[model samples]
Target chain A: AQTVTQSQPEMSVQEAETVTLSCTYDTSESNYYLFWYKQPPSRQMILVIRQEAYKQQNATENRFSVNFQKAAKSFSLKISDSQLGDTAMYFCAFSASGTYKYIFGTGTRLKVLA
Target chain B: DTAVSQTPKYLVTQMGNDKSIKCEQNLGHDTMYWYKQDSKKFLKIMFSYNNKELIINETVPNRFSPKSPDKAHLNLHINSLELGDSAVYFCASSPRGGANVLTFGAGSRLTVL
Candidate 1:
């Protein structure tokens, strides 16, 4: 079975700074995808970024980017120039190619301080 | 327009009661899913449907049932709700094929007293 792990249970960063959330996964499948999702107090799960296992270059979306290390099976999220709006519970997810199951890691509660 | 919408946004019922959560997606995606988020924020997949066909059914209790009239809609009905059933239910959808990128609804919070 594929499993996703997020070690940081809580994190905080000052506004305009940068923060990184760690994620690791255990999977034997070579074809897979990774995603980072943000859930605010409104309880709306929003897509942040995604990365493909075949692509070595990490995926970047505006201020959010992923540090995907496929060989090491590590996919971490880096939030640059963090803003107050970035305060939320961030989740790291994994889905094997052609599979409907999306395994999610325990979320990291991030707080952007002023 | 909202890509994926679910209602009622909040449901509160007593023990042994029955409840249902309706979900619909306007994104024209062929796959829909039901996920449960516990109080600790752990999210788990309950059921999944592709083109109105049951695809993935997790180890959820038999008290929970899911229905899909079409590819665009998936509804979950729970019988004999228990205190442990109190959690936030999320409806999500993805495109027709193997790409599992998902768009989720604003969750329906269920409280079983």
Candidate 2:
């Protein structure tokens, strides 16, 4: 069994600033995948970024990046130049390399203040 | 075009009634999954199908049945729905059975009265 934890229930960031959302997981599997998903007001789950446990280097998208510490079992998401559109509920998920099930965290509601 | 789509964007039904939600993906993925997001917004996997075969069945009650006619389609049917069953259901698909990223649908909101 695997579990993902997002300690923060809610977070706020000023416009144009940067914000980091923390996440931790417990998994006995050596090979796995970590993901961050964003659900906006439209309720569409969008993939933010992903990291492979085998990859020591972090994963970075245009404005989203992940700080993955495999040894610590930590995977955090960082959003840069946050805009109002970035306000949404973020979730951290984990899946074994060859599994179809994704274990998701409770989620953190983010608000971007102007 | 929508990569993954679920029909009946919203469903309102009475207790003990039976309902079904349809999901389809155009990505030609071999694996599809059904997840339930409760009122508190906690998403949990209920069932998973690979190439129309059941792969993962969580601790969910047997009342909730999943049917996959093909690799690209997976539908969820719930019998004797209860108030606790009111939640948002999401359908997602991944390219393969490996570490491929999942693409989720807009979600179906089911309200059991």
Candidate 2 backbone collisions, by pair: none
> What interface RMSD does every candidate have?
1.4, 1.1
Q: Residues B29-66, candidate 2, lDDT per residue (tens digit)?
A: 99999999999999999999989999999999999999
Best by TM-score: 1
lDDT of 1 by residue, A1-114 (tens): 999999999999999999999999999999989999999999999989989899999999999999999989999999999999999999999999988999999999999999
- Candidate 2 on A15-39: residue-level lDDT in tens? 9999999999998999999999999
Lowest summed lDDT over 10 consecutive residues: which window, candidate 2 chain A?
A94-103
Query: Scored by CA lDDT, what does every candidate get?
Result: 0.95, 0.95
Docking class of 2: high
